[model samples]
Target: MSSLSRRKFLLTAGATAVGTAILHGCTSGGNAPQTPASPSTNASPAAGGEAPEVTKAKLGFIALTDAAPLIVAKEKGLFAKYGMTEVEVLKQASWPVTRDNLELGSGGGGIDGAHILTPMPYLMSLGTITKTKKPLPMYILARLNTQGQGISVANVYKELKVALDSKPLKEAFAKAKAGGKELKVAMTFPGGTHDLWMRYWLAAGGIVPGKDVSVIPVPPPQMVANMKVGNMESFCVGEPWNAQLVNQKLGYSALITGQLWKNHPEKAFGMRKDWVDQNPKAAQALLKAVLEAQQWCDDPANKEEMVKIISDRQYLKVPPKDILGRLQGKVDFGDGRTIDDPDLAMKFWRDNASYPYKSHDLWFLTEDIRWGYLPASTDTKKIIDEVNREDLWKQAAQAIGVPVEQIPTSSSRGVETFFDGVKFDPENPKAYLDSLKIKTIKA
Candidate 1:
């Protein structure tokens, strides 16, 4: 059989096995507590519209600052305003935990949706990273935030002056390896956003990620503690953890990811496809609440209040100081370099940050293929169409009276140029793959 046909056969067979397992009371494991009961069919609708079929959903989020929109929506009663009074934004311990819970689903002790890494829904939908290898269909309702993630290096390499150019760090790793020490770098999860960023940064410096050094998974909240005990040399993750690392004097921020690719897409508001299909009106209500929260978060005047709310013990649980500076676009790299550029801050609504661009999804799938995470013959467009729910976003936007000018006219964001002068044109993904100097897959 051809490679593509073999892959298709495996996926189909695996799904059938998973279905049998579910029927026999065997399912993926997770410790997530049972969520509130599913939305009631009799719940009253909000003013001026038909009531949502369900008025409740359980959504998971990590402690990263990018999750602020979800936090804000719940904390500020935006969800209630949209008639979703029982929305629960629970905290997830790690990306893998999030995946497991999603697979279990709300009825089965998992979540209905989450504030997640942009590439994760696609990964889960393909069954590439699921525990049962059963495709868990998902939808991308909105892009939660862009930029703000960071690549931080332990103080051991502080003198190397490693920033965007990773050559200095590469030599240090090589020297350590020669002396019988195998250097390890960490990201939030394999084939996720942070993994792609860390890999791209290393590859751009002519260093092969998996061959020259070991790349491992480290949860975002554990990054600093792990580095302090000399667990990993470096890590890529979203803010407040990176900011906390700098505040604790454990590491220095080498570069905010915006320096890698300006305003790159990051976290997403994603829901299980089953939940969306069963509760279309409730889904739109949830999207409207998050969209309003995103606008509120992007406003400069609300920055301080937003930080304080998300820093509460129930949410991020970190001090507001660690999250505020970076959230305000004031970055202290902890290595004698600082920049105050609001344009580089994490954006929730400005510059169309909330829109789920098909082009961005394509880039992520292409990157997954490049790293051998997905089959080379994977149908990128079909997957994007199946997962991205930008149409839902537009409908919600119009329902909420969003200015027509703010709505994007095209799905593609055009060609994106990375810091190293490499460009990714969604129109021709093969050309972008061929241009990479280091990769596991041949275009």
Candidate 2:
């Protein structure tokens, strides 16, 4: 096929798929680096009353750049500022381990909580997604970021002069089909946010997750290595990993999830529901520290320094350059294409960013149903209400002086027009599933 024809066909078929915010740096004292300021609210404990110190608490995190808020909180003294000294932020290998560690309190005595994909707590609520029916009960302390998940493809595909557009994405797949070589793509976990985001983007591009393409679970740390060895062609994962690919010149980001859905929920601070209930003050204090960290990390002045801090062996352990590539919105697809302002994967604070809206939670559940993880006729609303920890989230926000907006009072279910007219909606997950002219399975 002519190159022009191939491009047009990919775009026309809506398969030309595929693919954060530029995090701003902050200047603290002009040289010392500004750490996040604790929200000045009632949750702030005074100098007296034993300071309400948390004697010892463990927190779990997977090593992604979005985990920076927590890392910075600990490294920059935000946690200590809030009396959460003796805080141990354990680096986990994968999302499931992170979730299990929090649920069972299993990481070297386990952890008090975790920074997790938004849907984990909800999925945990049903007691089906993971181990333990005890329902360790959880709450979203605050949203860490709204942007920063992306899809990436190997340099070999881009060497074919592949465009990162939807049409180009599909054409690359068609080429794969004609070549009779299986295309392997990776996601960090199944039934969580990354899986859903990757699945939806692939479905929208006319590729079925299981049938049209080979989808596998590879932990975030191994994604780049797996791609380098040709074990996978593309991957959908959180930051630093994608940045790792760019730095290694192995792959280019085919698309970013944030572009597909503006300000989408990516990660949140989660605590055992019981923990939040019993230590309401402590929960608020924890949220205060994290919120401050978020704001501090969001500042443009700190971006360069953040690159240095996150590159620490204890955190992402990647070169600062790779982490800086995507963090600064400088993306190279390795095919003689690069774009700045690649749309930042923002860590949204208050407003709609911080609120754990039922609509957002329901949308993920709908995807779970679409992908056969849940039965097709599942009661999405029931599952959403049971999983969405709005009550706890609101209390934490209020305690931290963060503003609480009213939850979206009405259901927003319909076709959502995304980049170049790609539509996504939860109302008719099936229709959304079916419209792509791609392969799909009944959930």
Candidate 3:
């Protein structure tokens, strides 16, 4: 077959696999039927004792384990308990689809908010990755999760034993290019968490992402299928896709992202700024419900039920086994390596995981600048101040009686240290960028 035909065939096969997964209960676009809201209750009073102005919200989620809090809130009646009776937690096909639906808004047959990549709202607010390059102001109410994502490598590279250090694959990628087969790596979306993770992994190994190997965007669900068809050498995505890849014996996880940066921020629960401004009480109600759900999901005793509920056809649609292990921090790298460390597990509420720290947001923006996704001249702090609604998170946590200890004393999580000894001091992102050996933006 011609190379073009072969490429098309592979993509088609991957698409077919994605379709099958969707049929088994993944969400696709705005047309997917909404999951019926749990039974309603008396409208819960908001922070200031005002009743919610509206009871419904159209929220989007992809089929990943980090999205558990949103799914749990919807299934366990948390949303309804907080007076959001008509909340619809619909499934989204991919990150780009989620962005499109969020841009459309509920009134335009889209979503009002989503379980989204941490950098996405800032990207959207800046109009960098939008349909018309028009800014859509957004507010991040709370962080959904911390540290459950993974970078996976194809079994072909098993001999190299590529893990957190990607240097082993640098020469291999160069050889492939010299041999007339340019390798490609996949992530979920440009400027999204997966993309940044993949880029950082490769660059840390002295591999220039877009230059050394093509970095393409593949929706999270399709990562396994695409790798199975030889469409990419590696991928970065949230679980249980990585676990599924290992389960299917298609690839071995290089590293769970916690190893990249322990307890690093992953996803956020964000909504259209206009929506939040117009319906402040309803917004707090939604936040309160999700906050409660986060605490529920964090409990070790609830792990079984949490996995079962999210594995249903309407949510993630995967076997509970594929999700439970990683969700509990029992990682089987699928290459005969296993570790049980709850500290590296996906955190929903513990360790202030639910707080939308301004420092974390700044790190994301700083990384975006490093990759030239956002200009070096960008005012990251101003954008972060405007977009990160940590104050609202504090309000919801207090309203829900979250222990004062759980509520962060400061918006910054302090300096974060990575597996490679790289430090990102929230107070000085410029120095962090300067310290990086490979970056598109010069420090």
- TM-scores for every predicted model: 0.90, 0.80, 0.90
Q: After superposition, how far is residue 309 of candidate 3 from its true place, in Å?
A: 0.5
Task: Residues 1-443, candidate 2: write the lDDT tens digits.
Answer: 11222111111100000000011221111122223333332333544352543545688898888888888878887677667777889998777777777766633477778888877776676565556554456666666777777888887777555333544567777787789987767787777777777777776666667876767776778777777777777888998888778777788877767677766777878777766676665666677677667766776677778778878998888778777767766766565666787345454442245555555565566566556666665565665555456565555445554432322223332234555465555554555556655434453
lDDT of 2 at 243: 71
Query: Which stretches in model 3 have alpha-carbon errors above 4 Å?
Result: 1-48
Q: Model 3 over residues 61-126: C-alpha lDDT tens digits?
A: 999998898998898888888778899999988887888998899999999999999888888888
Candidate 3 residue pairs that clash: none
Question: What lDDT score is found at residue 225 in candidate 1?
Answer: 77
Model 1: per-residue lDDT, tens digit, 1-443?
A: 11222111111101100000001111111112121111223323465664788888999999899999999989888788778889999998788888888998899999999999888898889887788777889999999988999999999999999999998987888889999986888888888889999999999998899988888887787777777777778999999999999999999999999889987899999999999999999999899889888888888888899999999988899999999999988999999999999889998887788888888888888888888787677878788888899999999888776777677767777778899999887778888988988998733
- For residue 246, give model 2's deviation from the true position in Å: 1.9
- Give the TM-score (vs. native) of candidate 3: 0.90
